[model samples]
Target: MITYNPKDWFTFIFRFHKADTLRQLAPLIIGISVYCWIVAFLELNVFRLSENSHVKNITAMHTLLSFVISMLLVFRTNTAYDRWWEGRKLWGSLVNNSRNLAIKLNAILGHEEAAHRSFFKKIIPMYASVLSHHLHAETTRLALDEHEHPELKNLDTNRHMPNQVASMMFQRVNRLYEEGKIKGDQLIVLNSELQSFTDIMGACERIKNTPIPFSYSVFLKKFIFFYVMTLPFSFVISLGYIAIPVVAFIFYVLASLELIAEEIEDPFGGDENDLPMIKMASNIKKHVAEILN
Candidate 1:
């Protein structure tokens, strides 16, 4: 994600970041400007309608519908942001759970049980990296170092990688319990963090698989398009040629909201605004190593 100081208002206002709505909407803005000029010219110069023409009544319709459109856009943007925030929270949970599991394992295992310590250390972070890749639908084998764990060897890439990694961690933990390394209560403590790995994975999958309703998204886009198209008719009588900029600016604002909603709705992707999955995964590795090693 692109990091910036929220307090620096002047920099954000003047500097156009790569994912800025202005860059994406520039072509559409120019097209709307030209369309507005044509509509204004035809109405004022050619048709020469009188001041009391019925077409001017479109302004009242626009004024009334403006509230409705604003409400819809607010809902759309809020829904998308909720998904983005939820994804961040899930990752935050994974980071904490991974550290918690490592700390418990470190305390439970004897110093001579370095093999068990190493296994939990690597597997805990590996689960996070595998989950990050799995959510993106990329090959998760790339996230693993094959030599790290024999249990992780020959992991079926065709199967769900996160589940495979989680299974390995569970099996090792169970083996520790069966071998009398971890007491019953210690196993119970570790179980919560281990189970949470699957819960986090499932929640992330829900966000990645599901999306904003198709019909609703399409309706919003259509509403914005038709609403802006009818705006020139409403403004030409009063705003005249100046309606060119006014109409274009209105389209820019409305369309930009939709564009932002689209980008943030799927927070797992490589978008600059997406949750920082890779960075969080690396932090999980670092934090797990510190606790376990």
Candidate 2:
């Protein structure tokens, strides 16, 4: 994310760093430029290859190829964006469902019962916060510290972390029913709320595990690089020195779009562009505390 906006033409041309500035492309760019210069020199002084009828025909074919490559890049970018957007939407649903579960828990637990109400209200949000942290592989330090109840401190278990946290909440709800702290109907309502939370967890896990096919990614990357390398030759005869910068700009734009799509394709990663899992977990903590108070 380069954030600065260039207002003037000078800044616009010079300020934007080429996106394919990756170290892997350095040797490729240098080699291609040298190759192109040699080709141009031969055409101009040595062999006069550009004047050959066959060379003219090959250049025309490359022009059509460039158009096809451009279309492929566009389609690849769109596909990546779809995956990124879908992951974001899933997280958005997780937030809403978590909040709904908390509100329902508070209502069913009976806010008038001081101890049971306070415990259930506080624990419901703790479940969300803990689950969020668990999803991101964070330790539940803050979540554990927030609850005053002794039973919550012992809620820790050895199961899959997020599932373990959810189970803790389920156990607490079961205890409330067994101890007569909540009625049978109230237990049923709380169970439904807990089930919704489980559904959210499952959805997030599915998105995190599934990804775009490896073959498609490999094919697209190969095509983009090949297209970029071949681009300058198509323009060298007509555009001469101008071809270098023009080809670079076009390659940079295509590479940048591809890189961005890669970054967002897995929204759960620790990348800056990834969904802020830590922040969401913290927010769940804050919201739960407010409801308890």
Candidate 3:
């Protein structure tokens, strides 16, 4: 995601180039211009329908339609933002819970033996980092070269990648129990932490798999196109030549907003506004290192 500080609005807007924005908006601009020309030709010559009374009625209808469209846009944007924010919040909880689990594990197992303490310290962060890597694979590949873990290199499985990593962690936890480093109760507590990781993973998966319905998206696109096509005819008599660019700009803003909502709706993807899973993993490494040392 674009990490904009509160004071960086000027810089943010100046350099704001999302390639998807151009891809979505280009066709919209072309369609609107072509539509305006067609409407202008018909209104001026063939129909001669650019009278004041006709314009007034069309303007009233456009106003009502614009209000309804604005409401739809607002609802769509709000829903997308909620999904984005919730994903971030869930990850935030994962970070906190991981740290808490590490601390608890240390308290329970640290006193048993220095070797066990070191092992738990090393493994907790590794587990969190692996989880982060798994979550981001759909969006971007994990930079294994930069954050190389010998343990991760050895992992090979045909099953789901994240689940495999979780299984590895569980096996390690079981080993700790079998070694008599942790009591039965401590094992139960560790299992709870692992369960939290599983829950977060499931939540992210749900968001990734479930999308806004295809019908709603199709309807929204069609409505926007039809609305822009009809706009110039409504304004040709009143605004004359000025109606062209005016209608184009209005369509541009509405289309851009819709494009942004779509991009952020699945914030786990490789979009400009997607969650920074790599950065989060790095932070997890740092925090884990601090605790270990």
Candidate 4:
């Protein structure tokens, strides 16, 4: 959601304010640093256990752990990015379908038909907004004013506002068909759009409901934790006081990867890297109105 000129890469990097990773991972990083420091201090100064530390051989595990952890992190990031990309694609499809539906409706009924134009202009975008809010698990969010969309009162009460809004679209199309405003091939086209609306919503719902498996996530976290935790043991003996920062950096990399994966795995939510649902819906509303204009 952080928008800026791509040409100004330096300013973009320096000034981007969405500190999502730092906000979440800073505490864990600090805790890991503190833990590493404590272990180093005790081993180097107080106990001197690191001087004769037999566990220096544990550094050998780092080769295999490093490879496994890298592969795991790669898998985790890819899985999350796949979900995020799919969400973006779905929203893109919704945008196209809404525009197509709007254009087809306007063309068929004549743009001078104020009631018909208004219905498509308002309702299609409203469906997007409602679906966006619904996917974020937010209730009581209305994109259209009651004066414009009196159905929100009924929609508010429905368990699934997006589907209800889509149903409303269907009813409107059916009305157009019965009144002969859009029948035959035109009806088929409109019905296809309606079906696309439903199908897109269903696809978004599937992504929202399903997630990266919990056990897989837990195992990765545990794997990274135990592996990085053993870093100080191997390191304090060799690096002396420098092991704290080294372990901390290692912890930062490993922990940040997991945190990032968690954040993006559910890309429907309002994260920095999430599909900008509200903005997309709002743009849909803007474009719909512009088309009618």
The clash count for each model shown is: 0, 0, 0, 0
Local distance difference test values of all predictions, in order = 0.90, 0.66, 0.74, 0.83
The Cα error of candidate 3 at residue 67, in Å, is: 2.4
lDDT tens string, model 1, 1-293? 89989999998888988899999899989998999999999999999976789999998899999999999999999999999999999999999988888887888888899888887778889899989898888887554456766566768999998998888888998998899887898888888888999999999999999999999999999999999999999799888999999999999999999999999999999888998898999999999999887
- Give candidate 2 misplaced runs (Cα > 4 Å): 1-42, 51-53, 111-143, 146-159
TM-score, cand. 4: 0.91
Give lDDT tens digits, candidate 2, residues 1-293.
23455566787665535442454356655665666676567555676545443554556666777788778768777877776677667656666766766676666656566676566556666665666566566566644444467766555545566676678678878987898877898888778867877787787777667776889788878887777767655566666656666766666666766777787776767666667766765576577656655
Q: What is the per-residue lDDT of model 4 for residues 1-293, given as tens digits with 9 covering 90 to 100?
A: 55657798787556635645656667887898889999888887887874566878888899778998899899999999888888889999999998988788777887567877877788889889888888989774665666775765676445878778888888888888898777689888888888998898888888889988989989998998899888988899989889988888888778888888888888888877777888999899989888875
TM-score per prediction, in order, is 0.97, 0.78, 0.85, 0.91
Candidate 4 colliding pairs: none
Q: Residue 63: error of model 4 in Å?
A: 1.3
Worst 10 residues of 2 by lDDT: 16-25
Question: Model 3's lDDT to the true fold?
Answer: 0.74
Quantify how close model 1 is to the true structure by its C-alpha RMSD in Å.
Answer: 1.3
User: Model 2 clash tally?
Assistant: 0
Candidates 1 and 4, the one with greater TM-score: 1
Index of the highest-TM-score prediction: 1
lDDT winner between candidates 1 and 3 = 1
Question: lDDT score, residue 267, model 3?
Answer: 73
Worst 10 residues of 3 by lDDT: 139-148
